[model samples]
Target: MNEQETGERDPGSGERVHWSEDGAERSALWRSESGARPPGKLAVADDRMTADAAYKLACEGTALLWRGDYHGARQLLAALARRVDRKPPKEGATPEESFHLYRQARFRRARVLGMLLVPLQISHEGTHSAYSVPLRRAPEVAQACEEAYGPPGEELTLVSLRELQGVLGAHEWRRKGVPVEALGGDRVHPRHGVFSPVRGEYVGLVARAPLPPGEPGSLVAFDIGTGTGVLAAVLARRGVGRVVATDLGERAPACARENVRGLGVQDVVEVVSADLFPGTADLFPRTEAGADAARADLIVCNPPWLPAKATSVLEQAVYDPGSRMLRGFLDGLAGRLTPHGEGWLILSDLAEHLGLRSREELLGWIDGAGLCVAGRLDARPEHPRATDSSAPLHAARAAETTSLWRLAATG
Candidate 1:
C-alpha cells in the first residue's frame, strides 16, 4: 500500500487522516469517506521556513504546517522571535506609548501563533496527530494541554501554537527555578499562572525595609496578593513571627504554598485564599480581651503597576484595569495597618510617566485616604526593556524607577 493508504484514520467520523513519511513530513487531511478530496490539508515540509514568510502568511491568515523535527520548529520560532525583536523603535515615544506597543506586539504574536495551532482529537485508543505539532516534551505538554483544554475526545482539541510554547517554557522555568539572590543564592520555582519575581528591585526593596519594632515572639505580617510568595518568604526569613500570604487565584495560593515550603518558611508563612484584606480581616476580631483588636504589624502590597485592561487571565498580573488593584490597595491600606505599623506599597512609576496616572494624583490619593508617606526608597529598574531603545516605551522605561513607599495611617 502507498504511504497515504497506510496512514492512521480519525476515530471520530473517520473523516480525517494523519499522514507521516519517515516521521519527518507529517500532515493532516480532512476528507469524506465517499472518496471525495480532503477539504483542509496541512502538510509539514523538511525545509525550514523563513520568519518573513511565516509572519506574512500569519498576517495574511495562513497557517504553516511545521514538518521539521519538534526541536527544529522551536529553533524557527526563536528565529521568528529575533525578527520580532528587531522591529524599529517608535520615535519620541513616552513610556506608556512604548508599553502599549510592547503589549500590542505580544498580543499580535499570540494571535498569529494561535492561528497556526491545529486541533487534535485524542482517545484512549492512543495518540493520533491532526495538525502536526513537533512537541518534544510530549507527555508534559499533552498533560498541560489536557488540563487547560479538557479531556481530548474524537473532536479536535484546540490549542495555540504560541501559547503551547509559552506553557512549555514556563514548565522548564518551574523545573530549573529562577535565581533569587535575596534568598542567599537560592532559587524560587514559580508554578504556572503565578507571578514570578524576576524583577528583583522591588523584592530587594521589601527585603531591606525596616520591620516594625514589637515583641519578637511572633511578628505578624500580611503579604497581600502574594504571587510567588517570594516577598512573604523574605519577611519570614527576616524574623517576622508569622506571615499570612493571601491571593485570590487558586493557582497562586498553591504556588505560594509550594515555594514557601521549599524555602523552609512554611513554619512562619501561612497561605490563605483571599481577594484582598477583607478576606483576612475575619481572623482579627473587633474585640480582643475587651479591647479594640490590633491589625497586622506590617501589610505589604505589590499591585500591578500598569494602568490597562488585561486581555486574558494570565495578563492580570501585568495589567491592572483602570488601576483597580492599585487604588484598592491604597484604599484598604489604612484600615489594615496597626497603629505605629507601616504599609509598604511597592510600585513602579511607569504608569505615571505614561500619563496613565499622575504622580501628584497618586500622592493626593495617599493624603486623601488619611495616610502619610513615612518614607520612600527608590531603585532604578534593571530589566532589559530599560536598555532597549527599540522598545516602544524606551524613554519612559529608561527613566522608570520602582519605589517602596512606606505609609502610616494618620487619623
Candidate 2:
C-alpha cells in the first residue's frame, strides 16, 4: 500500500495523520518538503510514483513527491529518457533543420530531467534532509568546488544539477580519449579545462600543407597556446623535428604533457608553461641565449575563435575576449619567426557573420602588425553545432568558414 492510503493528507493542509518518528521516515518527510513541485499547484500524497511517471507528469505540468529510495529516483529519470528518445522525428524537415531541432529538443529534455535530481542534505543527527544538495562524489566535487568557489562553509552550499552532470561527462570523455588520424592511429585524452580536438578539418589542413622548401624534417614549429597539444602532436606526426607547446594555465601544462606523452611524441615535443612565446624575455634580447633563442621555422596558433569574455576559465579555449590572444600573437609574430618563417593562424569568421567583428578589421590588424598574408587555406567546420540552426547563433554559423592564414613578417 502507498504511504498516502493509510490516512495521510497534504502536510501543508495541516490535517492530522500518522507521523513516523523514525529517522528513515523523517528523511522521506524532508524530501517531500524540498522536492521539486510545479508552481501554484498543491502537492498531494503519492508513494508509488516512478521517476518516469514523475517526469512525464512534470512535462505535462504535474508534480511527483518521491517517497522511494533516493537512488531509485535517478534510475526512474533514466527510464523517462528512453521514452522521450523513442518518439518519432518531426516530419518534412531537411537534415540541417532536423539537426538543429534535435539539439534543441535534447537540451530541453536534459533540463527537465535534471529537475528530478533533488539534493539530499545531511544533518548532524545521522539523518539527512533536503534543504540543499550534499555534494555528489563529495571528495572530487568538494575539490573542484574549492578551486572554483572558495573553501566550503555553512553558506547553504549549492550547485547546478546540470553542471555536475557536465563534470561527470567530461571525466568520461577524458577516459575514452579523442581519436586523431593525424597522429597515426593514436588518440589524445584531454583533461578537464583542456581543449579537445574533436573536429579534425583544421588539423588536417595543417597536416597536408607543404612545408617550406627545405629538408623534409628540418622544420621546428612552436604551437602557441597549445591547450590539449593536439596541433603540436599533428606537427610532430607530420615529421617536424622539434615542437614546443606552450600554455599559461596550470591545468593546461599538465594536460598538454599528458596528451603529448599519450601520442608517443614526448621524444620530440616539449610542453612548456608560458604566456604567449616562451624563452623570450620582454620582447627584446637581454642575454645572448635569449637573443639566439630558437626561432620557429613554422609557427602555428589556433587562437580562441570568438571575440567575447570567457564566463569561466574552462571557456578560455573557446572565447578570446577583446581578441587579446589573437592580436598579441600577431603583434609578436615578427620577432619570433626565423627568416622566411611562416605563421599559420587557424581562425574562424563566425564573428563577422554574427556582426561582432568585420573581416576588414582582421586584415587591418595583420597589415598593421607589419605582416602580410602570403596565402590562405580554408575548410568548413564539421562540429554538430555548425548545422544546428536552432542554436542562438545559427544564422551566423551557417555562413562561417575556418581558414589557415599563412602570414609572413614584412618587417
Candidate 3:
C-alpha cells in the first residue's frame, strides 16, 4: 500500500518511505540496551505463542517479533507486565534500600520487555495496508508513528511496542494538555521529550510571590530554563511588561514559544534558544538586546534540582550533574539583577534527602555567588508517588518539599 494512505506525511513523521538493501525486511531498527542485538535475531511469534512462554522468552533476553493479531499482542504485552510486577521483593532489604531496588528492578524489566518489536510497511498497491501489523485489535497508529519515527521513508524498522506506547502517551498529553490553575485554568501542552509542568506548587509560588517593586509603569522579568513557558506566561499575565525566557533543549524553545502564543502573551514574552542565558554563561539574562539591555527587576529559574546521572534523554530535565544549572543561576544572579531585584529559585530538597547533594553545599554555592536567601516558601509534593507506600523511595518522597527561595544579591 501507499505510504500516504497509511499517513506517512504527518509532521515530523517523514515525507516518503525508505527501504532496506534486500528490499524485504526493515533495515533500520533500535532496541533497549538490554534487548537482543540485530533485528535478524528477532523471531516472529503468532497467536499460538502462549503468554507464559512469551514472558519466559522475553525475561531470558529474547526479542519477540509479533505477527499475530494486534489485539493479541497487546494482551500478551499486558500479561508480561503483570507477571513482572507480581515478582516478590528481595528479602532483608530495608525500606529505603527496597525503594531503590524496586526502581532498579522496574527499570530493568522495562528495558527487557521493550524488545517486543512492531513493524510499519507498505504493500505493492500503495494503499494503506493492514497496519503491516498482524492483529484483529491492532490499531492504525500512523499518526503516532509519524510523530515518533518521522517518515522512515521506505526503510523498514522495528520499534519496541513500549516505545510506541510512550510516544502515543506524549502525543496525547500534547493534544489535551495539563491544566494549570495559576494560569487561569489554561493548559500547557508539552512537546515531545519536554518536561511537563504538572506540579502546581511551583507555579503557585510564581503566581503568589510578590513582584519586585519598580517604577509604576515598569515590569520586566527573565525566566531561565522556561520549559513549557508556564512560569513566564504567568508573569506576563500578571502584568509584567516584558519577560525573556531562555531554554536549551532541542524542542524546548519551540514548545515555550507555542505555549506563550497560546497564553496570548507572545507580545510580552520572548523565547530564546540558549544555554543558561542568552549571551554570557556567567550572568543571568546576559544579553545585549538594545532596548531590553538593562538588568531585570526579577528573574526566575527552575533548574534540574537533583544531582545524579540521567539514564535517558527525558530524565535530563530532572537530573543534573554537579548541580551545574543551579550553581550557574546562583553565580550569575548577583550581576544580573537591579538594586531591589530578586532572583526566585524554585527548587526541592529531594537531592538532600537522597544524599546526592547537601544543604551546606547549595548554600555555599549561593554565598560564593554573592547571593543570599531573603526568604523561602515551602510546599510538600501533592503527587501520588509521595503517598505510595510501595514506592522504593517512599520515605524520601514523603519527606520531600519544594521551595521557592527569594534570593537577593549581596553587595
By TM-score, the best candidate is 3
* Cα-based TM-score, every candidate: 0.77, 0.65, 0.82
RMSD of each: 7.7, 10.0, 6.4
TM-score of 3: 0.82
Score each candidate by Cα lDDT: 0.70, 0.66, 0.74
Among all windows of ten consecutive residues in candidate 1, which has the lowest summed lDDT?
Answer: 31-40
Residues 57-103, candidate 3: write the lDDT tens digits.
67765667667787777778888888888877787775546646765
Local accuracy of candidate 1 as per-residue lDDT tens digits, 181-253: 7888678987656667899999899889878778644567889899889999999888898888988957788
- Residue range 257-325, candidate 2, lDDT tens digits: 988888888998888888888775443233236365557888899999878755445668877889999
Q: How many backbone clashes does candidate 3 have?
A: 20
Top model number, lDDT? 3
Model 3 lDDT, full chain set: 0.74
